[model samples]
Target: MIKHRLFWPTASLLALLLGNFIANPGFFAIELRDGHLYGSLIDILRNGAPLILIALGMTLVIATGGIDLSVGSVAAISAAIACLQISKLGDQNSISGMLGAMGIALALSLVLGAWNGLLVAVFGIQPIVATLILMVSGRGLAQLITEGQIITINSDPYKAIGAGFVVALPLAILIALTVFVLISLVVRKSALGLLLESVGGNPEASRLAGVQSRRLIWLTYLLCGLFAGLAGLMLSSNVSSADGNALGLWMELDAILAVVIGGTMLTGGRFSFGGTLIGALLIQTLTTTVYRLGIPPETTLLFKAVVVMAVCLAQSPAFRRKVLGRRKPKPPAQASQTQTKVEIPA
Candidate 1:
């Protein structure tokens, strides 16, 4: 089952790489300059890392059959808050001020996460409706933080958070790896994974089993928000600007696509964090491939749509049975002359 679960995404990624290689032989090169990795592959990995982090959290939420549409907005808000704080520390401010801003941004993210939890767990509101409220308002709040202005900071420490490298690998990749490991440990080492799957598979059954389904759902969203906050910080750090409108624009879709492509069902139940990582990488690779091939950027969305449709169709049981059912063996026919032949022999 595990092998089968991984087959589609793996195959798709392999095919994509092969196609890109055919189009451009230079797609696989990795170069290091000035102690930093530089390559098309590295760029894809770096750019995709934030989405991988967000998708990691989304995997847990989707496992409980819930969606957090507010993640993109949460990211924007986090970035704005972080940038606003850093802006307070003039361009000449010391590293300590930058570090203080990061701390504040992280704290605010946790608070927002807790707010999401309270609404869904305590108020019992539908996940979609509850998250949507923030999805719309969160951006506004981010804009308000900057007073509708884009605050650009020229701090090296802040820039390093996004664009810096550690041991030749992008810092974003490291952050993504850390988050992946932490979340994996929490889910697999504890009862959380089983509880989440059970709730997603059948909420009523889980409730009867004494699982705190609502609390579980709420916590998942909170985690999603928290990750979104991290992603926002990474994004703003990369550009050194808090443009709320462009911070995490439409990233919720990408995160959802990563979750779905990772083999997590939209209805929820079982989820694969590793699969989400693969999915994020695949998406980034696709975009990079398109750009390298000189294809119009707008066409990338169409490609994404097609891939998503194909994955959804492949996962549908009805579609699989329909395609597989035709190959079943038919019963053999009885011979009509067998009795006559036996009688003659007798």
Candidate 2:
């Protein structure tokens, strides 16, 4: 347990939860009311659902030796597309209308993702640089979609995606969980996970071994874009509106942080879906804890930084060795004196 990659992040999340429970006795209390379960824990999962999705997607991309810096922008654009389409509907309450809007948005997301994949995999551009181009232009495209205005709607089905409850659990949480499980099964049950790690660990070697490295890389970016779109949908639906400028602003940072906290290396290779889940919950809990404890809003970023740094340091082998102070062996005690048999042999 001490040396496992999951040990530190899991410990950190539990410690945070325990501290909150200590500070507020009801932190873990869940209540059943109006056919819905409610509590601090529920809120964390509900609010962190989008983050979990994006982090999962980011994990895949990072595992393929690539990064998607345009997730936030892509999310904003997606929300704008969905909301705008729904706003134009004559019957906003129509489930079919909402589905159609979502389809259009998700399709656009895939295209954008494919564009990014093309840049990085086919054109041989740096992942960061390739994604950056979209990162800069996506916001403008979102504005264009929304005509520089916030698109609002009154579709219950659409709202349900983000805020509704299913079997007393938030629907958002269920969606994220479902996606996580499906993705996990797909990648793990087959050779896909190993292939991704191989490509990430050494692209040239993977290629020489007959792996289609570029296709794999492109696939990961496409997945990232798709998840970012889903996240945008949940975010905009929660508020029943999409403000292109603010829909997914700065969310890419949180997704990246969550992936990192989950023990996925920025350099790519192996990854942990379970770790990303815990990391996402930890981040959401931290934010809630800050407000619950009455910390100044201005210092929220600082507080998060401290906690993240502490957890990362806790996970570091060098840091642990420094703190624990490795004791040098007593030179095996020199056996004090050799037995007389040694002298006879000489």
Candidate 3:
């Protein structure tokens, strides 16, 4: 279990939960309220849904040896696009209208992803530079879509996507988990996962081995945009508004951190779905612990950094070996001197 890819991430999450439980005795307490489960644990899942969704996409992008800095912007644009369309609806609560709005947001987000893929996969631009271009540009586009203002709405169906409950579980949590499972199935059950690892490990080798590296990279980016769009919808719906400026600010960074903490190498290659899941939960748990323990909001980043670094070090093989130094073996000459001569052997 200790050697499992998800072991450290899971342990970190468990530790955070334990700390929270220690800090607040009621942290683990859960009660059914209005047909839905309510508790700090539930809250973490619900709130972290967006991050989980975003991180899943980041996983795919990173597995292709690419980074998507524009995810935050894509998320913002998606939320803005949805809210703007919904705001113009004759009845904001219309489920069909909300669905249509969501579709629009997703479609545009995919297009944005394609744009990044075009620059990187087709035009041969660096992934970082390609995605960065859309990072700022997409933010501005979102602002333009929302007319530089927050778009607030009152749509029960739309809100439910982010805040509703189903079978005693938060809808957002279910959505995140369902996406995770579905993505895992698609990637693992098919050849896509292997291809991604191959391309990420060595694009030149993969290409030489007949892999369509360009298409794969582009496809991953497109999928990343789609996932980021879904997260945007959840975030906007959760608050019932879209603040173009604040909708997904720095979300890319958080997703990246979550992916990294999950044991996925930033340099790319093999990825861990389970690790990402555990890592996202751990992050949300830590955030909850901070506020529950009455830590000041101003120091949240610093606090998170400390805990994340500690967890990271704990999971690092080199760091662990350094901390738990092995017993040194005697030199060959000393061993020979320590041994008794076998005169009968001659």
Best by lDDT: 2
In candidate 2 the C-alpha lDDT for residue 176 amounts to 99
* lDDT per residue as tens, model 1, 1-346: 5247767787788888888878878878888799888987789889998899889888888898878888888898989888888877756257888877877777787777777767877897787888888889998998889898898988888888789899999998899999999999999899899999999999899999899887888788778878888998899989988898778888888899888888888898988998899888987887777677776778878877887688666656667778878454668988677554445554
Candidate 3: the clashing residue pairs are none
How would the candidate models be sorted by lDDT, starting from the highest? 2, 3, 1
Quote the positional error of residue 316 for candidate 2 in Å: 0.6
lDDT of each: 0.84, 0.92, 0.91
TM-score of each: 0.89, 0.94, 0.93
* lDDT tens per residue, model 2, 193-302: 99999999998899999999999999999999999999999999999999888888888888888888899999999999998998888888898899899999899999
Summarize candidate 3's per-residue lDDT along 118-178 as a digit string, tens digits.
Answer: 9989999999999999999999999998889889999999999899999999899999999
Indicate the TM-score of model 3: 0.93
Task: Look at candidate 2 and tell me the lDDT of residue 105.
Answer: 93
Candidate 1, residue 318: the lDDT equals: 65
